[model samples]
Target chain A: MSTDIAGQAKKMGYKNIKVYLEGEPAWSKAGYPLYASNDFISKGNIVLIDLRSVEKSEAGRIARSVTIPSATLKDKADSIPKKAPVVIYSDSEDEAVSAMKVLKEKGLKKVALVPGNIAGWVKSGGETTSGPVVTTIVWKRQMEKGEVSITDFLKVAEGSATDTVILDVRNQDETTAGMFKNAISIPLDQVGNRKGELPKDKKIYVHCTTGARAGMAAKDLINAGYNAFFLNEDISCKDNTCSVTE
Target chain B: MQKTLIKFIPFLIMASFLTTGCAQTGTTVPQLIPQHGTSGGSRIQDRPYPIFVGNVSNVSNKAKVIAIDVGKGADAKTHLVKFDDKTKGIEYAVVGHASIINYEMRGGEPWATVIKAKLAQLPSGVTEIKTTELKSLLDQGTKFTLVDARPAKRSIEGSLPGAVNIPSDDFKAQANKLPESKDELVVAFCGGPT
Candidate 1:
């Protein structure tokens, strides 16, 4: 896509075409700073960390950012969820960069630096909160709309629940190798015509090998007034046993 | 006859699903048919040279090989290309990050000549920007258009503060978003090196 854009720019007679090939991932990995849009900084599901001293943070800091001073970052790293993107800001660029390295070394891949640190955030019309600083990092993986939790899906798969039915939306050839013992086979393309075969009272859980087709099937079932949810995970089954991975 | 028909119904359903399912999903069923073709011939000599672009799935520095995952889902395939001192930007081929590799067939395997996080070959007259230069430009509030060529979803995650999104997928349609002057300095970036 970047190549395509570069070609399009060249065709338009743009003389000075420059491509930042290493782009965002490289930039962030190097501890170079990034600017999260105000909306995302305020509302996005990210672990915003203020790396300023407790005194400075208590005076004023970006709203929703947990105060984790640069000095104590190494000790507090374990509390930070590796999956949630960590956005940090500090009094100085060096401090923030060091903190980023600390998190990265601790195996957090999604660490990012807020440009200009907290001062920049305040300068850019971002909201702030004063008073005591929040030190604890609290986060949970939020499910997308119409998605089922792995726990719930496993319960149904394990036959602990009888109120829900598992719908296998993979192709017939895929299931010929193996399939869930109680699952009803309905390829995604045939779901519309075969909707009447499923009971409306029972909750329908749609699943595919990689969840793409299952999501589509879930949407169709949802529109058809069936209580449907899709399992958004990689699932493989063989000999009546299934393994699921996120 | 009734019992036989009942037993064969599953096969009939399977046949119908294979035909209709593959058609609708645009995914081919993997076939295990034996091949009956001449061996020891130039497989790609007549075909246009292929360049594989994808995220690096694995990098075996010890083995001097990089495995790239191309395509997605059912059509996905991995290409293991051998690299050496001649391979450019080998350091940037980090795992799970984008890389572009153009290779030559060596002993029936692809041997990478160039491995880059960006285009394996840059268009003539175009220049590449180092990360530091971009950072300095943004810091100085340079009067140039910083374009985020990545998709909208990625840009939303985070980008340069003043960068405008002109996703490469919608470049032509969104040309108006670029500066009006053709001579204006424009820098475009995407998810590192793709």
Candidate 2:
């Protein structure tokens, strides 16, 4: 398999080809080193670079992985080190390969790309940095507003507030297995279609297995002229009705 | 008689002229061939995938182009292209079927290559490509938003990154709340078969 790769490179009339295994499963089952684009390269004379946008990098990135977005590589080529072994990775291999070329042009000789992207690395059991959880734009908004905890939502459900509406934004398949008895399922993708089904008079409380979808739903309801809240925590509606306190 | 006959003949000829001249033409003529295959017209888009163009090892060529895989072992029907140039490193085409894949940059051009599929074409709704390893990258001050399209409750923990919660149910009503700027990187995920 490797033999043809070199030949293919030669046929394309190029030298210095770096190889990446095609798929994540294959790479994982085979057991390989995978890391995020911004994976911390504190040791091994390796420099990890995060090619995601500045916003993503700000949220979290590998330790020491510089922010060199794929789009800005040409302008920022001089920053990379020539002596160190560099490994490029991203969720998108297309971006990773593009960045690799930018670096080579800057005269960095020792460079390679990760087989699978950061996701592949994690699936393959690699360690990484910890940071704040990302919330949906709606969740982010709710978090900013400081209203209702997961526990609070549960309390309302358990108490049977007549005016409250518990909306489950998970897909139908998820709801089929069982969900909060008081909750009505309206999947995220289908919300627009079923807008009429939702009650405008009710103060809606939204949720999902985790809080992200519920946050988004609550945000949507608020945007659509309905007052809504989200559960800050993930609640399992199985065995017993999940309450905010639980 | 001769005078009347001549007057009648004139009238007959005039009527014949009117009848023949008033008839509508209904035939279509072939138009000229276009000068170029797509002069003003758009190039037939690269098949659903972006083509990956890059350099291979030991070859003294400009750049080699390859079709990238859209999904896991899904075949090369819709591959995104990556261009690997020694001088430019790697640069991808903006108008391909696949989404722009990002990687680390070295110098002038990129030598190696990778590709990403379009969001709609991603293997499944729940394909968590970067879940296992993106956490630390997030820690490095790389700010990115991972969106859980699941309901808020399902995504309280075990998210790939500090993922935002966007319920698919309310995505449209809340689309306005999403980042309006293109510069903001947003990724959406669901708990489906990805």
Candidate 3:
């Protein structure tokens, strides 16, 4: 947590700051119970993937963590959600960073690395569950079912002017270049929390710079009871005029 | 029958980015997507501008933008917010990060209704003092607590001449270390509500 942590407490009506020099290590040594960060596991919404081998995960792992391993991430690219904040951990810091790139490439929105990994978790007194190692890797079967084609999308967006809404699921920095003619910009990271803003009166069409994030958002919106579909193709825009392909 | 549908790639990846454009006659203005940073951030504005920082109320589970006070205690006025990415980086959460939304004072539409409406207040036993007042107090040698609510990583960069370092996170846990005097004028502060 950055000063933003303190900023939040103050915002919530707090008034002081103290220092713990030993940090998590000393607290762990003292047998203090270390808990997962709020952002990672709060509300059972965050998805944690263990990048280490199956043997390592089975030995002892953080509760509710999934397994995708760094190398095989490409194979399961569509499994992760674009808006949900995801935590990727492994045996070492290097492995975690390597695995993070996989998600970043897919534009999985906000991703973070757990510094301590299994060792750090142990040092911090986090409970270690050793068993058959139930995994959280629930592969999303065939997302192309809800796929929207470029021609079909252009038709809805520009065609008969039906009740079709274009949802853009990219970040603030990326949109400075420009956007689709009439799509709404609700960043992929905040889509889940901002679902209320989405209009249910129209047929929703979600898209991103690449189709990676759009696919994730499509799945999410559909599950949430919205008439939504993802434009699973590459698209670009400048000065409000966008060009779509595939 | 199994069929493979291959979609071409690398045609400008852009959507929902049009800030200044006219939607066709059939379409409406950009409604749902709040182009937050694109607006007031790039516009010429004075420092210490009005910025609302809180969960977007009314519409539950979403973060909205209504920067600045509007007579009502709903949103807060801007204070010295230390939004340094190095020492004080932003953190993301389910609700979203500390959204430092900047907006040019529009025609009193945003502040009238919606979003956070609670007046931010200082915690009990805490009183806010201005930098000038603090300096005066230091010059007059008024004995008081000048606690920097920042973490150790930030304090190492150097704090006030005599301000005690106490990261706000551990402040509650280390309450015993604070002055035992119940009457001591305790002043607490940190990167004000971002």
Candidate 4:
């Protein structure tokens, strides 16, 4: 993609254009700290930690950030989920960098620093909150819109829901490997023509390997005046047993 | 002239009914009326799936989803498409840019099967820099402008030290951020080769 930009620069009458094709990931992997954008720091689903003194945090801290002073971070490191993308900031760049290294050593991947720390964030027009800092880490995964909840999908798959039908939209060849006994197979391309075969009164729940095809099938069914929803998740079924990952 | 008009009146009425019939059903009309071939490759093979050409309005890298603006003005509609490892050419989708998407629909949402960016080829004049060479230049205090060509958000997350951001999408408007001397050596990079 950077090459695309170099192309534009060349067209704008610039003679010297060189592309660093390896880009940001390479720089980051080589033990360098990356600066989190104000937007991402403020809005992204990540754990924002303040590694400054508690007094400094009480004076002001980024909103939604948990207070884990760099001095005490080692003891509380186990409490932080390893998978969570962590962003740490402090008044001092060295302090933040060291704290990030601590997390990296603890096997916590995706750790980053706030550029210029809190001062950089403030300079970039980012807002902060001043009060007793939040010490406990609280995080939850947000679901996308139009996705059927995993609990509801599992209920239907288990045959506990009398009025719901599991519509499997995988190809016939795929179904031969394994399929839920309750599911009615209908390849996606044929759904437009065969939708009438399904009962309109029953709620239709759709699924495919990775939910892409199921999503498409659910849309076609909904357009055809059926009460349909799609499970936007990964699922595998064999011998009447299935596993779902949320 | 009146006699000729009267003879054609029945055919005009039939055409009006045909259009209204499609409007009333609003189902599979796009399939019935094949669109003109706008992309390369076999038109007949791609006939079953509708093609959308639009700017990428938003991209959620974490969520692995992108929204494309397929309409204009009052008629504008944004199609949210989910992309996974199977999605072809998805790495080229940058926010606030345009790409050609061949998609399938579910509940009126587009799921992109393939995404293609225009002008993917590197221009003849540009030179490629290796990571080690760029690092040596930074260490040696080389006198050159290092441009981060990724979006502002990505660049902020982490970019090379001393690199100025000039996102590819807004390159034309932000070109002034580059050095004034046309002869000045400028190096650019993005979220590479992913």
lDDT, candidate 1, A56-105, per-residue tens: 99999999989988878889998887667778888898888788788888
Off by over 4 Å in 4: A71-84, A92-95, A98-110, A122-125, A144-146, A151-155, A158-246, B1-122, B136-144, B151-170
In the order shown, the chain A TM-scores of the predictions are: 0.65, 0.40, 0.43, 0.63
- Could you give candidate 1's fraction of true interface contacts? 0.55
Candidate 1 chain B: minimum summed lDDT over ten consecutive residues — where? B27-36
DockQ values per model: 0.24, 0.02, 0.04, 0.27
Candidate 1: tens digits of C-alpha lDDT, residues B10-40 = 4333422222100111111111000101221
Ranking by lDDT: 4, 1, 3, 2
Extract clashing residue pairs from model 4. Answer: A35-B156, A35-B157, A215-B106, A216-B106, A219-B106, A219-B107
- Candidate 2 residue-wise lDDT, B80-177, digit = tens: 12245532322322222222233333342222344432122221111224533443544575555555554443333222334455554555564554
lDDT per residue for candidate 2 within A184-243, as digits (tens), equals 788764554566788899888877665655655565466567777777565665454553
Error of 2 at A9 (Å): 39
The Cα local distance difference test for each model comes to 0.71, 0.45, 0.50, 0.71
Better of 1 and 4 by TM-score: 1
On DockQ, the candidate that comes out on top is 4
Q: Of the candidates numbered 2 and 4, which has the greater lDDT value?
A: 4
Instruction: Encode model 3's per-residue lDDT on B1-194: one tens digit a residue.
Output: 01110110010011111111111101111221123223454332323234433322111111221112111132222111122223111232112112322323333222221222112233333344555555576669877665555556434332343556566556566555445554454454443222
